[model samples]
Target: MKKTFLKIGLLFAIVGLLAGCKDPSSEAPQSEGPSVSTTGESISEPEVVLTDEEHNIAVNYIARSVPLVIERTGSTIPTNVFRADAEPPLPIPELKYGNDLILITYGELKYEDEINGVYLYPEYTVTYSYLEGENYASFEFAVDDKGDDYAIPDYPRYDAEYDSGGNPIHTVPPAKAARLYATIHIGERSTRFNIDMILHPQEIIYEFTLDEARAQPMGKIVKVYGYFNGYFADWNNGVICDGDVALGLFKINDYREYMQIGKLYEVIGQYTVYHGLPQLQWIKRVTEVAAADHPTIAAPEAIVVNANDFAEQLDIGNELSGPLKHKVGTTVILNFPLRYKKMLDRDGNPVEPGSLELGKHADVVLTGKDGNNFEFEVKLSLNYHMGIDDQAAFRDFFVANPTADIYFTGPLGAYDAITLAPFAFEGSLSLTPPVV
Candidate 1:
């Protein structure tokens, strides 16, 4: 079996796990070359202990109805008078909210780190879900002083601070933040991450009130507001959808429409960490309309969402979040594996004799799990000329020989250098099927 792993997830999802690396955002550090001038002291990476009272204070501070900054004795040092290599190391900080979930996050300085030989993927993954029992996101980072690992791909990180209109709030210098961010991917479930921002010199300026999604508006201006889900960030117009625990559908007008097998999209939708991989709510831009004057009246042919001029008034619904464990059927619908077989040869190229060769069997399906009751029309490969016509022939053959029991005999999908044709033979399952 040729296993070619594919990446699927949100634009801000996790990619690879490198040891030693703090967070993906811990790159292109702030004092890359050291601050221009002043009393340059920074927060050092230390093992600090906090009491239950302190933890509650930090939690309450973050979830406050109105954003306010809390003073940390250790963070009293300012960012003035810093040298390129004089800055301290970034540490992994955690805060337990007692009632709410725990938050373990690294500071933004890590993302701004500028050690000549040290390089980390600009990947930030902090996993924490309100969904009990299952929730965790980790990362492994390694710094190559010799710069041997340098096959860096372009993973553009969008800082939505200016509202598409030019404005600088939290101002950081201009640099690629050249850190290797791994290929993004989608997971098999929904996840969430919690981030808190702390300022230097002043105080913890503004905190997230359990709803606002914060973003880097300008160099130091961190804009905080309400975010719908942990995955969907309002900064990029991200929205979460239903039936998205597993396969997410990412869509946007600004992005390329045509999707290829290997091509990946940094889709800005709702996402979370699931089973170590980044799982996000599928994001797709769907035009929905509502009556501008009255929020309800529908145009006659208003079936299409775009039909309503006041589409902006309508809201995107939330995911079906209840108990973390929703008892699906005895077995999960997704777990019902589709019986498949590689009717083709090792060389994804067509077989000389387009016919079902001996030594080949298939897992044939009699009906679709959706009760479509569909038995695929099967056709044995005739003479090595693989094309859509062959699929047509299979349908034709199935119509003629409905009971011939001829197993599939053609390449399901074979492109240049890539041959993955897991042609389904059956639909149902045996033994213990999966559950949602």
Candidate 2:
């Protein structure tokens, strides 16, 4: 069996090598988001994927997806806390077969076979360092998969497991999804991602299975919190996590505009146990912006990002105190998830749905509002024929204005980044200084 696996692996290695290293500048569509394609390229000489060396490429890739979060800032991911009675269950689209709490504890380098969907990875212990001000809160997350060198949070016997769909089961119910901020450390290198969140109310609907959606007498809207990066924003932020939430992610354009990897935001998602992972469903984005003090903007050699139609720019000064001024109505949209109903149909449901209108909201780091994060429904029309999801378009949704600030978010707080929620300013916004 080992030899056969090796033979197949060797053949795949050759094919992967033949695929060649793709051009870095080349762009492709990503179902995950508008990010670059992550297909591994082949080198002239295919290197052995599983290296005896600790912390290899496989580990790094997984780490990016499964972050080593530090809750030095807060126990919950969101600072704006709502009653549990309000939100729905977690992992709205439902990745696995069981109602297990799904948690994405961490990611490490692993060699995966495209044909078999198998991952060969190493094991490492996960630990954390708590900072001051952030209280400690115990959260639950099950390690669905662990490797020879990898040890999952709970499962003790095997390195990994498979679901009915044959996909790898990796989830951890976010124990601290309600935290205000936390500094996480992963692996020996202290790999950490600082996550700060503020939870609030939103109109999220995640209960309708595909079949049930069509049978509904009327459009059933649910409410949840609005999540946005940079908790420092003065207004409410986050998305509604109603309905088959994952189905919602598919309906928006520039989904990354609503969310990203290394930043702070308020996630108003449903708190449910999917495959043993605690997760919040984001229906709308109260706001979204880059990190403050990050090298993406702060470098003396910083180059402005832009294009005729769409592009990103960096400010040498404080990211707070203003919005990254662009065109009159330039909006970044996220493709949140939403699924169809699962109700019984005699003749089966129609082959096509309204392209699956997923829950969506604009990416805004609110300049002004009462809550740190918020998401409101606005009348939006889509020109799906024009390659744009109406939900992704910018609408006069959030009432932009500034008052209080959610300090749990670091310097690049939305309130600090934006002048007002609706963006009402005659002149340029004032420069924001770095937080000490």
> Model-by-model lDDT, in order?
0.23, 0.26
Regions of model 2 farther than 4 Å from truth: 1-67, 70-124, 128-138, 146-204, 222-436
Best by lDDT: 2
TM-score of 1: 0.18
Model 1 agreement with the true structure over 1-436: per-residue lDDT tens digits = 1222221221112212112124433233111122111223442332333344433333332222111111122221111111112347332222211011112122211212266443222212122211111112221222234321211112222332322222434433211111222111112221222222111111123322111211212222222221121111112212221121212222232432333222222233333222211222233222232225322222111011111211111111112222211111011122222232223443344342345343332212221122243332211222222233444343344445444322221122111111112222232223243332
- Assess candidate 2 and give its lDDT: 0.26
- Please write out the lDDT profile of model 2 over residues 1-436, one tens digit for every residue: 9968975675444334322322224222111111111233211212333433333444444444443432323222221112222256221011121122222232334466678665565433333222122222222332323311111111112222224333435433312112211222223343332222212111223443222332333223222222222211111222222111211121223354555423333332223212211223322332343345222222111112122111121221222122232211112221111111221112223212223232322232322211222322111121122222322222111122123221211111121111112212111122232132
What total of clashing residue pairs does each candidate reach?
61, 139
TM-score: model 2 vs. ground truth: 0.17
| Residue 376 alpha-carbon offset, candidate 1, angstroms | 4.4
